[model samples]
Target: MQKEIMSNTLKILCADMVQKANSGHPGAPMGLSDIAVVLSHHLHLNPQDSSWLNRDRLVFSGGHCSALVYSLLHLWGFDVSLEDLKQFRQLGSKTPGHPEFGHTHGVEITTGPLGQGVANAVGFAMASKYAQRILGENVISHFVYCLCGDGDLEEGISYEACSLAGHHQLSNLILIYDSNKITIEGGTEIALSENIARRFEAQGFDVFECDGHNFDSIDLAIKSAKESCKPALIIAHTVIGKNAVGVEGSHKTHGAPLGAEVVAASKEFMGFEKDQAFVIAQEVKSAFEASIAKGMSECEKWKKSLSQEVQSKIAELQNPDFSQVQYPAFKQGDKVATRVSNGEILNAIARSYSGLVGGSADLGPSNNTLLKNEGDFPKGRNLHFGVREHAMGAICNGIANYGLFLPYCATFFVFSDYMAPSVRVASIMKTQVMYVWTHDSIGVGEDGATHQPIEQLSHFRAMPNLLVFRPADANENIACMQVALEMKAPSAFVLSRQNLEVLSPVSKDQVQKGAYVILESENPDVILLATGSEVNLALKGAEMLKNQGKSVRVVSMPCMELFSQQDQAYQDSILSNRNKTIAIEASRGMEWYRYAKVVIGMDSFGASGKGDDLFVFFKISVEEIVKKAQEI
Candidate 1:
């Protein structure tokens, strides 16, 4: 009876809040409230200590139900309060339209993008499994639960992430699908027709079905899912809006507030005071607080059970010593692909940093991201993310948010388009994730225009908090990783497919400054600025210009984001912002306008040919740079 009342309490609060905001989704919260009540009993979490490592993770893939999220966070004894709930959907409020990880006290990650939370759940599960392998079951044992709706499952990324989750047999993962059979466009029958149970079953999940509002059935399904030997999916059948006068079970309630009169009617129907808003009966509060206390007790018991080795392991993950990493050395003039160099640097870091773990999207051979002799995830360092690029990026973001792993995902530079949404989310969350994007331009060679990246470099560089590195050579690639790994944000290492000449060693400290003069000329008549493969071309161009009595300053701008952060004085020291400044790169180079007066960039798509032939055809060669410099 208390569970029933608590479910209604949550529903009423959700309805009240949405009605007050006049612009929030109330349907999902109302529909999922019963399941949320049942889940509260099984979920292990301490609001008193939200960072408890052994606590089960809960992800709401349908973030539109944020009213439910804030209510749960408040009722479960987290820092969220009734006032915070009142401020729902307001700017500067803890309860934003979508739950933000750093902004909200209990949000595990930023979710709003459909299907990302499903993938994040897989990532959390995978991270826990791997941590358990390292610290033993007693120190690292936890389950991951994800509540997702039709929109989440309908997105392609969900399929990609779920496929990988099943392939990995992540037994600790449980995905609770809120099978409401409704979307914003009306009934899901208007679009989706797949048998979701069969799809999950085919993907190797242990599938269960339950009446969402039936407490006993929901509890039974959850208990059964917990016992499964593989990742589990429980489809909870529900209505879009379970209880609202005139609006019940209709898609109209999906993204709008339940009318005040209707909310009053619904509350009265549930045996609550029709006029009261945000009322949690003392009995319901006690039940929820008791659950939190139980979770705190479990957290304490787990803390006491932690062995010394496990504690040390946990500490290592929390405070990684980047200084301990032994970077690989490269000699000047040595020919090596930035991809190969980054692979060596990655292995070097993996040998020292146990938290450094990731893999490529079925492009390990090309991306060169395989950790040497370190085995596979749950026991080893490599995490084979399959060909699911979209899932790969989101999963890596999840691992980063899991609080121990410094995750990375790799693919051909051009394929990043398929995964840009995840990468964008990672940047927004500021997850310490690395991206190894090889074949960094038309340099992908014979793959043709379809496979070559033209604008990826500038597009990503434009993203906030994401350090996009277009390394000039093997040494620069090493420096980029060294710098990227030390920072607490997402980064992408745009590496070369073709071997580049290793320039004279640049200190990691210098690389941290973002851009510097790689080759200096006394009283330079022109500044030749380039990145990645074009830096070497700039050097040869500078030499030719010198022979032609034109003094040149060749600068390698590896990371424009970092450079932008530098003070104007430091920026002016390298760039000087002169009319003769020429920026050259194999990509679109849109952001170069800030530093260069003349930009020589890819204006059109590339075609199938050898990488060198493609460079020549695209005029991304030393001759082109020289011509541009002379004009400047």
Candidate 2:
């Protein structure tokens, strides 16, 4: 009876929040209230220390249900208060329309786009397995619970991520599907017809079903999922609006609020005073408080029993000591592809930082991202993410949330489109996941336009909180890697497939600052700006212009994002005072106009041919650059 009251209280709180805000979803939360009651009361979590390492993670994959999440957080005595709930969907409220990861105390990952949270939960589960292998089960053992709806399963990323979870045998992961038949358009039967349980079973999940509003049925389903040897999915069959009087089971309640009269009547139907709003019975509050206290006690006991090695590992993950890291050295004039250089630097760093783990999206060998001789992850240091680029990115974000792992995912630069959504989320959350994107231009050769990246660099550069690096050569690649490791935000290292000449007298610190003068002449007539493969062309062009008695300066601008962040004075020092500035790259040149008078780059897709032939054909060669500089 007390549990039923608490579930009703949650439904009322959700309805009140959405109705007061005059916007937001209420139907799913109302339907899923009983399940939330069971999970919040049964899940092991520390409200006092929300960042506790071993605490179970609960993700609201159907993030429109944010009101219920906020209510649960407030009930569990996290920093979310009643006032915060009242401010739902308002500007600057902690209780935003969607649950943002870092913005909320107990929120695990920023999830709003359907299926991302499902993939993120898979990542969290993977991290748990890896952490347990390194830190021991007693130290890192915990389950990852996710509450998703039909929309989540409808999205493709969930399928990719869940398949990987099953393949890895992530038994610690449990997904609760709120099988509410309604979407904003209407019933899910309008579009979806696949048997969800059979689909999951095909994906290697242990599937179960239950009455979503029945406490005992929900409890039994959860328990059975916990005992499964594979990743589990509990399909909680439910009404759209479980208990609302006028709108119960109606698609109208899916997004809009139940009107004031309907809400009052719904409260009365649930055995509460018709006019009462956000009312919590004393017994309901006491149950949550008791559960919270028990969680805190368990956390304390676990912390006390942790071994010194586990403690040290935790400390190391939180505050990595890169001072002892010996970065690989590259000699000047070495003909090395930046991708190969990345592989070398990555291996060197991985050898020292046990927390550094990642894999390519089945392009490990080609992307040069493998951690040499470290083997595959769990028992080894490498991660084999297979061909699933989208899931690989979200999984890396999940590992980043673990607070002890510096995760990275790799793919060809062109395929970044496949993972762009996850990358955007990582940037929004400020997770320090590195993306190693190789084959970063039309220089990909014979593979043709489809495989070569023309606009990807600029696309990523435009995204806020993402550090995009296109290193010129071997030494610059190392410098980019160092900056990526130290950055608090997510970063992408766009590397070249073709070999580049290691420039003489490279300055690692200058590269870290985003750009530096690689070749300078006194009182230059033109400033030549370039990045990646084009930097070599810029130098050669500068020499050619100098031979024609025009003083020229060549600058390697490897990271436009970093350059833009530098102080105005420093930016002016590199960009100002030239008679004419020309920017040269192999992709779209529009982004370069800020620093240059003329921009030389591709405006169309590349053709299949030798890389050198394609470079000249696209007019990104030294001779073309020299000609363009002369014309300027």
Candidate 3:
């Protein structure tokens, strides 16, 4: 009876919100009401203490199911009010159509993009385990539960995360699939038909089946998952619209609304009073309120246990200092490519920073994310994010949100576009997730324009609250990494695919200041500014001008975002509009017009050839830089 009342409240809330917004997904919420009611009412979570260290995590991988989530949160005593629901999909409202991180109070990860939440759940599971192992004791031991749909399971990213979850045998992870056999396009059979349960089973998950609309079945399935010592997946078969009259059991009602008239008729069919708005039975409300105190009591017990554990292991909990996770000891002449230097620094940081966890988007070896001799994050130390770049980015945010790991995600710079939204949200939250992007420019020869990142550097630089650093040499790369390690906001390190020389004369301190004096010139006529692989070009070009009797200053601008934050006087000192300036880089010059007198940038797409030839074709050579400077 309590379950029935909870289900009615969820359905009513979802219908009202969508009807008011005139723009939202109603089918999923209606279909998933039973599961939502069961989890919110019966799961081992405390509404009174939302951030309990060991509280069960609920991630909605099928984010379009947000209506269902919001309804549950509202019923279960989050800050969301009736007015907040009324303001759904409106500007500045917390209850937006798609769940947004920081926008909504309890949304675990910003979901919207299909399958991102699924991967985020994997990260959450990993973070909890890592926290327990490093922080010690059972201070953090809770299952990461995810509610997904056909769209989520169909996405490639889900497969990637699931594979890693299976490999690590993350028994604390549980996924509940809402198998309604429908998508926006039509029957899922029209597009996809794969053995989902068998797939998860092969991935080493304990699979269960149940009737999604049956509260008893869902409750028992979740219980089975909790008891299992391995990751569990429950495929709950359900109707598209469980009890919405004519459309109750069909795919037609999966996306479109039942209309006001149809909604009225459906309400009658479900034995509800006519024209009732946001209706919830008093009995059901009382029942949920009764459980609130019980949930609070259980949460308090967990809190006491955590407090006791902290007291026993104060030293390990406090100074678990991971500030130096994956970096090398700072030295004057650390000669290595930015990518190589990144790996070395990351390994060093990993040694001390137990919370430093991350993985590559399937390009582990190429991305240089694997640590030497250090254990793979095999569901234990590091993360294996598979090939899902977008999901990997969002999941990294979740890992950071776990308040334990300073999560870093890696991949080629070009592919970072796919993961942009996830990284963007991380920036909004000021989560210090390190983004390691290798193959920074047109230097990725033979792979052609598809692989070469002509506009990627500019793209990252465009994002607000993000630090985009492209190091000139090995030492500068180390310096940039040191800065990333210390940052409180999101940072991206762009490295070259080609091996670069270890240039001398620049120190780590200078790089940390954002722009440094690579070569000072008295009475300089022009400033040659460069980043990444092109920094050496600027130096060589400056030499050519020097022989020609031109006093040229070379400045390595590793991080434009950081440099811009410097005092106005310092900015003027480093780069003056009064002084003729030539900026050189290997990527598109779209972002360089603002700072240089004449910008030598890759204006066209790259071709298949040797890296040097590609550089020549793109006019990214020191000779070109010298010529451009001479012209200026």
User: Which lDDT values do the candidates have, in the order given?
Assistant: 0.90, 0.88, 0.78
The TM-score values for the models, in the order shown, are 0.98, 0.98, 0.90
Task: Determine which window of 10 residues in candidate 2 has minimal summed lDDT.
Answer: 503-512
- TM-score of candidate 2 to 2 decimals: 0.98
TM-score: which is higher, 2 or 3? Answer: 2
User: Residues 1-632, candidate 1, lDDT per residue (tens digit)?
Assistant: 98998898899989988988999999999999999999999988998889999999999988898999999999999999899999899988999998888889989988899999999888899999998898888777789999999999999999999998898899999999999888988899999999999999999899999999899999999999999999999999998778787898999999998888889899888998999898988889888777567778999999998888788889998898888888888999889999999999999998898888999998999999999999987689899988899888888878989999898889999999988998998888888999999998888889899999998887898899999998999888878888987898999999999999988888888899999999987679999999988998898998998999998898999999999899999988898856879999988887888888988889998999999998898888888888887776
Candidate 3 residue runs with Cα over 4 Å from true position: 135-137, 249-257, 307-334, 361-366, 378-380, 384-391, 414-421, 442-451, 497-517, 520-524, 564-572, 607-614
Error of 3 at 483 (Å): 3.0
Q: Put the candidates in TM-score order, highest first.
A: 1, 2, 3
